[model samples]
Target: MRKDRMILRTPLPDRLCHWAMVVCFFLVALSGLSWLFPSLNWLNGVFGTPQMARVLHPFFGIVVFAALVYLFIRFVKYNLFEKEDRIWLENVKSVTAGDHSKPLRIGKYNAGQKFMFWGIMGLICVLLISGLVIWRAYFAHLFPIPVLRVALLLHAVAGVGLMLLIIGHIYLAFWVKGSIRGMVTGYVSHAWARAHHDRWHDQISGKGADKTKPGSAR
Candidate 1:
């Protein structure tokens, strides 16, 4: 936990954005589900009342989308697939078992993380587009009834899919011992980085051919 022994994994700004987005996403999701399921109608009170929830949900959804766009710009390079990602995929069983004996040459984000990153990005795009088409206060009036219905269906599907992916993301964060701490503090111990992201550790530590420039990963 000492500064000298820890590596910066996420910068403060990124962490702030991430947590803010989390708050907005949950509010938006809950309000969305309230309308999607009659039994959960009470959830619409998240924004004080069902009427307020209706007025704010779309705006909060936009906030989530914008935050994700910022994150995508900041981390997409690290999440892109590389030749070494194949090793992580091949040894996924070991990874799931928490075995770190083998050096998988993992980078800042592994193959599974890359897939999750892309999946989230893709789903957000779908949600945004469909949401706009079905947004009664805005663009909905421009579309035909049939088009609006299709957009509504797509919005629901994409919203549900994004929520499922986020659930999986949270589960994995908890499953990995140091993941939540890393995100919260923006730092991880050298041992943690080495064990989970060996290649990235080496780069930052000046032990690999590609030395990480100062502030590059932030």
Candidate 2:
């Protein structure tokens, strides 16, 4: 693990925000789920007491939203779709089988990662809007009961959806050998980047490889 061979993958601010948001998200999610499920009611103890959980859940949710907004601004450019993404999508089976023979021309983030990025961003925005609408201590009174009811429904749905996306994210992060290490240490081995994101590796290393022509599915 020579330091010289590692490439900066995640910056310090983004890593800090990401882990901090993970903590806040779990706390808020567990507390909210406690209310939604009779058997999971004990989860409200996440904030020490059920009453305190109710008081702090909204605040924690706001923190998660803020962290995500910061991440979105920082990473959205890298996560945008590109022509090469179609190749990656088409070779989805090969990716899952750990076969990298195809010149997928993957950049900093692959098509699957790009999809997850947008999914997380879109779901978080939904959660924020609905959370604000149903925030009992502050905004709920501003809206009619009907609107509040609808907001509560949408908030719950968005929360579960975001949690599902996050579960998939966690799974893939661990499944990819160097991904979690990159997030934690802000770096990845050159070989890992070259194997997983060849185009990005080429761009950063100035390898001068020809770009994959558009519509070249192979």
Candidate 3:
């Protein structure tokens, strides 16, 4: 049965923070490229010079970390695991095929997204710690030489991992048709919700059957 549309999914602050993080990540990526590859000299033009990028990357890393921390704190509850996650994980193939039968009946986030949330959080922690260790003007010399070496290697690995995760994140967002719109406009249609998240849809729209509502029939 077809249903009406919804108003919005994400809140304004969430959307704003998401975009800000995107911008900051892009800046960091560009700055890294400018210095990481001497052969790719043209990248320096994006930030005026390689030296200039070196100066700015750390500053914007702080910005990205702060914005990401805000997003993490606000959405942490939404990403917590629920019992339905097991069903969702087991039905991954069917779910990808667009199956909604006995759908997991998730609340805020599904299993896959919850995994991503924690994975990214770990990446952020690693990035921040390693970043501080190698921050030449700040703490590079304070740490022992052995520790600094390990930190540099870890920073490189974390950077690569985050980039790959980001690509996957964008892919998933676009894969779910209404997802991009949620982050872009902070709203979603009722139909989109019902089709994609039937259980959540019913709760939000006060549909025929809603388990989340009090005094409702099971």
Q: Which candidate tops lDDT?
A: 1
Candidate that beats the other on lDDT, 1 or 2, i.e. the better one: 1
Comparing 2 with 3 on lDDT, the higher-scoring candidate is 2
Structure candidate 2, residue pairs in collision? none
Error of 3 at 136 (Å): 0.8
What are the Cα lDDT values of the candidates?
0.91, 0.87, 0.76
**Tens-digit per-residue lDDT, 1-218, candidate 1:** 58767888888999999999999999999999999999999999999989999999999999999999999999998988999999999999989998999999998998999999999999999999999999999899999999998999999999999999999999999998998998999888888988999888878887643344522541
Q: Model 3: runs farther than 4 Å from truth?
A: 1-5, 37-41, 207-218
Evaluate model 2: give its TM-score.
0.93
- Which has the higher TM-score value, candidate number 2 or candidate number 3? 2
Whose TM-score is greatest here? 1
**Clash pairs detected, candidate 3:** 5-190, 6-189, 6-190, 8-187, 8-188, 9-187
- TM-score against truth, every candidate: 0.96, 0.93, 0.87
Ranking by lDDT: 1, 2, 3
Name the TM-score of candidate 1.
0.96
Q: Is candidate 1 or candidate 3 better by lDDT?
A: 1
